[model samples]
Target: MTTPRTEHLVLPGVLTAEQAAETVAGIRAVQREDGAIPWFRGHHLDPWDHTEAAMALDAAGEHQAAAQAYAWLARHQNEDGSWYAAYHDGDFRRPTDLSRESNFCAYVAVGVWHHYLATGDDAFLDRMWPVVFAAIEFALRLQQPGGQIGWKREADGTPVADALLTGSSSVHHALRCALAIAAEREEPQPDWELAAGALAHAIHRHPERFLDKDRYSMDWYYPVLGGAITGAAATARIERRWEEFVVPGLGVRCVLPNPWVTGGESCELALTLWAMGESDRALEILQSIAHLRAPGGMYWTGYVFEAVGDSRRAVWPEEQTTWTAGSLLLAVAALGGDEATTAVFGGDRLPQGLPPECCTR
Candidate 1:
């Protein structure tokens, strides 16, 4: 089903070489010649999801295309060192959402570090250093008193004071990756180091500092997915909400009691499970999402099944998405021990925070 060039991309028996090739092709098909990958052919592109798709390309050995994706970010970045929350149809001339989300801005660091890890290209990292620095500077500016960063800044420059737990957790992970990049280049960002420490503290000791979105599945799994929680604690966190968020042989629910299982959230949970050393469980989770796969190696955003009353379950959202495919590839790559994927998700390889020696939060 795939040419010989794609055979090397296989992840043992987990994914047939053909499947991997088709998935890569599917992602590449949605990416523009200029390197911007949209959620779908006509859907909006957000910074965080765009980077996720780029990382998937790198995992597939499409290094030049991945670099081009980063180039697109470098070209369209605002003077304030951030991209808007969403660009309509991935067009620089048509940004649909003007909000600058902290998590969205910080995610570029993760993608840059991941690319460097995959390619070992010093020049690429060099070119990206200023971009990462500016983005982190912008993100840290929104860090509140309790180490929880504010959610976003409005289009008109008004700061949203409320912090989101899931977004903060993701930003926490990005900070660590940014620190690693700084360390590699001998750039001493003492402020970032200090801020990262405080952020981790907030995530670990003061979850109450963030806005409560406990109803969403992201609040249940993102800390572990973000590398802020690990070992016994991470396992416990997954266990605490597994029944509420996960549906056996189907996938993970986007939110409870909604009967909606989403491809992105399900794949992310699979990656998190792999990071926790539960490979069997992780594989099972990935396998359960097979129904979400479409013919072109694309995946639907989500599916709603018997959500209310006795209505039969059916796929919701008519379009397939780039980020959905991206998340699946990343999870599969990690399970297959792809060097960059494992390094990025495995918290052990990065600089961890030093918790308070003595004192309750």
Candidate 2:
């Protein structure tokens, strides 16, 4: 029997009520007592993937666990409001990668807002507001004049001026969520509003501002997934590369000219399709990745669908990442009409910051 909290997570061909509960439990099991959610028990934790897992907990109505994940982020946040790109799961103080990524920092706002919407906990929102504010500020400080955000700052705090399309698009979505949080607090941030508009303008009009990574599926769809592209443009963009990235019965390819299909990318594409109002197609995409589902309700990171001599398709990485399962839960939540997941991904109620003049002309 599906508990009310997880009832909405059930999706035909994707997840049953019991399976959904087990998946939620699997994520919970990976979360440390201090609230860090690593990719798996022995894996490193990145802020972006950690937050993605936390958001999945919220989608499953594991509100306290999600809140604890945010609390962990607050406790570990650098004085400058950014987190290291990766941390050793066994020790938060031991960062495995010291680069501070703008998109990684910005994603906290999205997760925070989603938790608030899911639980309606005013105190949690109040507590996390400063965290979100500082994070967005840190991210915006890396924004280029052309509106695309620099991808990261080196360990020595040197900013990398070259931007990535996927990272900036994700930041655009984060900015809008940050703005929504501000609106809820009755705090107006005109600067963030302006930054968001400029960022979206760059995403929609200035692909040249970003480094070329077109072979990756993320670069192909993140503008739409991040809510920076919509309507006919979004539909057209997805169609343009549908055959290139999507592997009909397996999942989405992680990159071009590779036979690997990743659960995370496939689920994110499903969410993107769901956000575009193609719920049936989204469901089909979710259903297609059933092979990636692992025992105990977790999901494999990806599969190498093209076989080598004497071998069939295999789970390439031999790991089940929390974020992969998290993405699946989120996609299922959105498709199953979970209000908070729908609201966050649908973008209908989120504030669209002031449009830059470039966008108008």
Candidate 3:
């Protein structure tokens, strides 16, 4: 496939076509030859964010680069189907975080499914099936009876008993993608289907199964963002927490009572808005964060703002990151009407797996 030109990418109100191209170039620039994309140069790579950056490359029409990034995951993945919480840039052997996070391992399915949608490359999908399957299998091993997956495993491979709402909800999304891959390959995985249903049920009906993290923006929105909660429920959830996590005329706060507006979270929220068919609101949210855009087409990780009385605010923490740019590109792609982006993020294009009753038959 020919590499996509930036002019064709949808940038909405916040980015010019040229700026969009720069963002693609910026993500490509940070990628290692081994196909790994880290947070930035000299930074470590985590599975989830690395997958996010790779998806941005695919959205930008860098198909080979995106495939390469996934190859890195396949090459470096632990035998247990997990990657450590962090891997030093370009050095898979040097793990910086010993923990094996379920959400991190689970995210590969989302990335793999998105890549297949973008390219329609059956061979690529077949080649990556083992990787996706292993990752999901490992992740599901952490799932509790109540449907919440454990947050992570200790370095010694013991599952952490606690679950986080954000992580479990995200895993529910990943499990859906994993099942889609299996179906396309004519591979029946009843266990995966049930696991997905259970996870969704846990996310929707049993928030108590996961630890309370109401103060964090991800915990508030992830159930909706991950597709476990939809329709009126999704709308109510966003509205209920709007005042807590969102900063009008600015962006989203990572945590309540914190002055930080994070680019990654804001962009994901924009996608969630788009998925709910609120393009106008999504575009506005994206526009509000234009201040995070860098000259090089990368976006700052986030800007910390403090209100010093009189409603005055100041922004700081100046640094562009690959994942931030990736997320922005993904959100813009959905707005731009990229079929794959719309399918995976906007439309219910990816399967959400079957509920328990269907699984029995």
Q: Would you list the rank order by TM-score, best first? A: 2, 1, 3
Please write out the lDDT profile of model 3 over residues 315-334, one tens digit for every residue: 45556789999999999888
Task: Give the per-residue lDDT of model 1 (tens digit) for 88-112.
Answer: 8899999999999999999999999
Residue 303, candidate 3: C-alpha displacement in angstroms: 1.4
Which regions of candidate 3 deviate over 4 angstroms?
A: 1-4, 307-316, 356-361
- Count: clashes, candidate 3: 0
TM-score of 3: 0.94
RMSD, each candidate, Å? 2.0, 1.1, 2.9
Identify the candidate with maximal TM-score. Answer: 2
Candidate 3 overall lDDT versus native:
0.86
RMSD of 2: 1.1
How far off is residue 211 in model 3, in Å? Answer: 0.9
The regions of model 1 sitting more than 4 angstroms off are 1-14, 307-311, 354-361
Model 2 CA deviation exceeding 4 Å by range: 308-312
Tens digit per residue, CA lDDT, model 2, 1-361 = 7789889988889999999999999999999999999999888999999999999999999999999999999999998999999988825888999999999999999999999999999999999999999999999999999989999999999999899999999999999999999999999999998998888888998889999999999999899999889999999999999999998888899998988999999999999999998998899899999998889999999999998777788898999999999999999999988899999999999998888875451
Q: Per-prediction TM-score, please?
A: 0.95, 0.98, 0.94
Pairs clashing within candidate 1: 305-313
In model 3, the worst 10-residue window by lDDT is 1-10
How far is 265's C-alpha from truth in model 3 (Å)?
0.9
